[model samples]
Target: MSKPVIDIAIGLLLHHGKVLVGWREAKQHQGNKYEFPGGKVESGESPEDACRREIYEEVGIGIKQWYAFDRIQHEYEDIIVYLHLFYAYVPDDLLTLIQQPWTWYHRDQLMQLNFPKANDTILQRLFWSHFIKIGDKLSEFQPHADSLFYWRVDAEQFQRDVLHTYSADDLTKLILNDEHYQQLSDDLKPLIKTLHLKQHQLMQFKKGDLELGKRYIAACHDLVALQHAEQIGCEAVFVSPIQPTQTHPHTKALGWTQLEEWSKQSQVLVFALGGLHPNDLAQAQLHGAYGIAGIRNF
Candidate 1:
């Protein structure tokens, strides 16, 4: 006989640099562990609806907006669980209502606490919140420590040169834009583990069509593109033109309000791109970006 599969909706509430977490009951299946607020998904209820209901029931607060983050499945001795994770911000006025067993902890403190084994992947993704550098020349840009690179040069000769210039560990950080990525030689392809998809390429993408074990990131402009990215299993999406750019000054920027709206609307991790610098990190986070992607100021 097989164990029943159960669905769970989990919510991670962020407010003033802290995330809400609760302790599981001692007698429960995964007891005595600290967990992001959530509960089982009931029959006939959607995961998003279940998440909202669970958070309200457990924390005494209502969440009107949330962005989907990631999902995972794990099997314990008794049952299999499919976990859907979402991220939302809690208002300052409601902070006082979050009480005992449900406490707010700084992001850094999350890893130190005990959580269910299935949470390992989500925890790691949160820990490595990113910054991405997008451009041609490596020497021309100085990115933050441990930042990822979106190498956009398309010349086949230049692409190979760049790939061979960095060590394997360093190459792993590179997400080659589609043109350069497609031009790689068979041997050189394994050096880079991520692929950056242009809007058109993303439209044609399907699971199993690309090499396995690599991460795919899509360039998304709006909700429709974002939904497509999510459906195709992109690990992240670059939503661009957050500000008018030097490259295209006449192109109207999305501005902060629209950026925040896109972040709320999409489940995939959102990277704010265009006319941004490292200094914009705090401002971008305030609007709910997973990271910032830029060319000159990376």
Candidate 2:
């Protein structure tokens, strides 16, 4: 009738390379389909409260804590459904897929899934890429160039808003505080293993001012640093403003062609800045950028 919209809670139950997906009774209209483990929100509940309730009812276990994720607003039929979604990281053994309505699929086995929306990129990104992994033991986080969460804060003040909140006792933070590296709030320092230096902070004393709520990626523009990254032992650099940015409208960006050329000579990892988003990571990689770093996306 009314584009049957429902509040759903999905669980990512992974075990032996398989993830659990659930559906309703095999032949109903919205049935016989696989989705995350969740259901509708009761009349008096908040989405978070509803998500917890729905997961326990459908999967018969509790989610110790869930990360706040996307708010998907989509059109399911003649009407629009604003689905406030979250991700719950549960153990692999917590799942029991003997229920006729449930099945488990691995990352490589997506072709075998029957969910109508699984084909949409949203599902892949939501379940696979977006969730920041937590609760892993120290032995699990093998430090490599791969798992680093790189970000660029607009000098000293910006760090207060973006980097301050995600603190847990264990996460190690590496920041290029530019000129103000010494100015970081003392309370924030004990929580992290801090490394502050001049070369990484090139953008710190740049010509223009930063915009509120808009943070772009950029190469720190220290040719000296580029020559000495190996000697200095640094991993990445931000080269930016390939397009006109509000913060540095006059600072002509070293466009993609130049970035490619520069990248070949520099041993340090490179990222394209200016105006960027999470989706830009792929484009960045193609152009010799190891990853994209920006405050706007984080």
Candidate 3:
């Protein structure tokens, strides 16, 4: 039998002035060098647990707000290794007491450091810290023009036979957990076509439960919604009722005044998602959005 394979979990730690990296002294045929902080994952231990243990043992600090980021597999030489990379933001103060011989490179200081295959891309994305919800297959993170471009679709568009579906964060988790839709939300699936995303979503003015995040779409403010989108790493947020219509005609409309206001001071991308269409895009852009997004046009 091929020798029993070992799994590895890595923590990509970011602090005020440095990122957590570790040196590989373990004996393996593969070249040993500095790498992200991690150790071989025990069969029974969860990835998160492994990461925490490795960090605490190697550096003597705690990780907070840990979240699953990516799972990558690679063949360095003859052996196949699986890497589960987790993201945890660290406070700026922890950079002082680190024990290991770790290098503290400024964000783009990769030239002198050694990075594994998937580490570069992951690191770049994490640094930008902004991602747009494209259709189900992909989500654009980097900017297209003056603004970050994102393709968004509502829950109504998800079940349709369309090629791409955009979703919020929660809806994405649901799609991933589904046996059938597990691969449905694959971010790299649509590389050949375009960037897409599937977000479960939260709102204060869209048509869902107010307790969560959905609002009636009419009650939301343009600036507040834009900030929420940026905070969640979304490239753009949709603001509706620009023209006023039946779906939510009763809800107050922000009208041109709000649109003009958004154009002046908002930091995130805004899509006119209310009773609007392709022709109306010019109006939205004129007010200050990169472009207009709407279900009616599609």
Candidate 4:
């Protein structure tokens, strides 16, 4: 017989840039794992009511506002869980009311902790939406010419300077080579808005493997590369060398005509890269390009 699903309500309480998490006690179902504090819905109780009551019982705090985030179903060896997730804004002063051992973790730090297998799907969705929403909101006020910024840096430079200076609101995405992508710490991964991968790096993994719970864009120079990126469900693709570039001056440029032809064929958003300047944005868009990416032009 199939296992029955247990309906549970969970809340992610956010304060500042962190979310509240509690360490499960030894006697609990998923012992020693970190979880967003919540419990199963009682008979006749709504999910939101259960969530609020559970939080008060567990941590002695009352939350007035929460937005429904997602509903996830996961099957474990013994039971199937139907988790109803919600996101709420909590006051900093309410931290003193926590009765159990709890900590406020930044989005990046949550990846390093041990969570129940059932929570993985909801966790990924939460962080992905969090960063993307920030990016969308920031873009609304910025100039159209500054819509995107390409960050091309070595691993050392990224950690030493880029991490300290730039934030998700500061750039559209950070493009990294294979070596630099591999060198990033687990705690730093969630802070990335959209991570751009080189062609070879993207080829090493299947659709879901390269997903670090972030939006991904892949570099493409040919039809095969573009198709591969689309097959893997990349958010965007970068088609380069539209004009002579100082970095690769020896290679011939794919001029506007070819760039437009390729862009029209792309299943995913096409970013016109290589020798691009702010002045080229309008022209690139005229040819079906989503946006332009560059190294020094920004």
TM-score of each: 0.59, 0.39, 0.47, 0.49
Candidate order by lDDT, decreasing, is 1, 4, 3, 2
**Residue 53 displacement (Å), model 1:** 22
Q: Please write out the lDDT profile of model 4 over residues 143-207, one tens digit for every residue.
A: 22324444555554555333534555443344444455566667555555567778887777565
Report the C-alpha lDDT of model 2 over 1-298, residue by residue, as the tens digit.
5676665544444343345677656675456666766666778888878877776777677766554444565675454555655544445456553344566665445545666553243344322221111111222332332333333334433434334645543334233333433455767644433233344443243322322111222345545555453223333455665555667778876676776776666544565666666677777667766555544343
Clashes of each: 0, 10, 25, 0
Best by lDDT: 1
| Models sorted by TM-score, best on top | 1, 4, 3, 2
Model 2 TM-score is 0.39
> Where does model 4 exceed 4 Å of error?
1-145, 156-179
Q: Write the per-residue lDDT of candidate 1 for residues 169-240, one digit (tens) a residue.
A: 566667787667767888778777778888888888864465444567899877788778766656678988
The lDDT for every candidate, in the order shown, is 0.78, 0.49, 0.50, 0.68
Off by over 4 Å in 3: 1-4, 16-18, 25-29, 118-121, 127-148, 151-200, 203-298
Better of 1 and 3 by lDDT: 1
Deviation (Å) of 268 in candidate 4: 0.9
Candidate 3, position 272, lDDT: 64
Top of the candidates by TM-score: 1
